[model samples]
Target: MAADDIAGLIREAIPDAVVEITDLAGDGDHYAAKVISESFRGLSRVRQHQAVYAALGGRMGGVLHALQLTTAVPT
Candidate 1:
């Protein structure tokens, strides 16, 4: 999938999130994403990552091969 598609999915889940998606390998299968949202403020790192993965709705191991994900609360 495309970077924009990934970003869109995250945005849809977290309306106020700032999502930046990078195509790490330039192959469209490897990606790096930085997600910032107020909703993540009190969540554990694993939970934050889970929220993101949930946004993808099972696309992670399927259509999306690899994703380097970093999530944080808005500064």
Candidate 2:
């Protein structure tokens, strides 16, 4: 999948999110994403990852695989 597509999906789930995607393997499948949003402020790391996975709408294990996600609230 494209980086823009990943960012778009995240943005759709978290409207106020700031997403940055990096193709770790340059193979379109492996990626590292940084998502910053107020929604993650009080949530745990697991919860934050869950939120992002939910945003992907089941694409995590399907079309998209091997994602390294980092989430944080804007300072």
Candidate 3:
């Protein structure tokens, strides 16, 4: 999938989230993303990543290969 398409998926999953997605290279399999949302407030880093993965509905396993994720609660 395209970078923006992947970004959109994340946004859809967390409606209140602010998502920034970037393809690390030309390869769609690798990506870097920064997401900020109130939903992440009390969640640990691992949990935050898990939430995003859950939003992808298992796509992370196949369609999406690698993701470097950063999650934060809004100030």
**Tens digits of lDDT, candidate 2, 1-75:** 899999999999999999999999999999999999999999999999999999999998778988999999999
* C-alpha lDDT values of all predictions: 0.96, 0.95, 0.88
Best by TM-score: 1
- lDDT for 65 (candidate 3): 91
Error of 1 at 21 (Å): 0.5
In candidate 3, stretches whose alpha carbon ends up further than 4 angstroms from where it belongs are: none
Give me the runs in candidate 1 sitting further than 4 Å from their true place.
none
- List the candidate 2 regions with Cα displacement exceeding 4 Å: none
Cα lDDT of model 1 by residue, 3-73, tens digit: 99999999999999999999999999999999999999999999999999999999988999999999999
- Report clash pairs, candidate 1: none
TM-score of each: 0.98, 0.96, 0.91
Error of 1 at 23 (Å): 0.5
Reference-based TM-score, model 3:
0.91
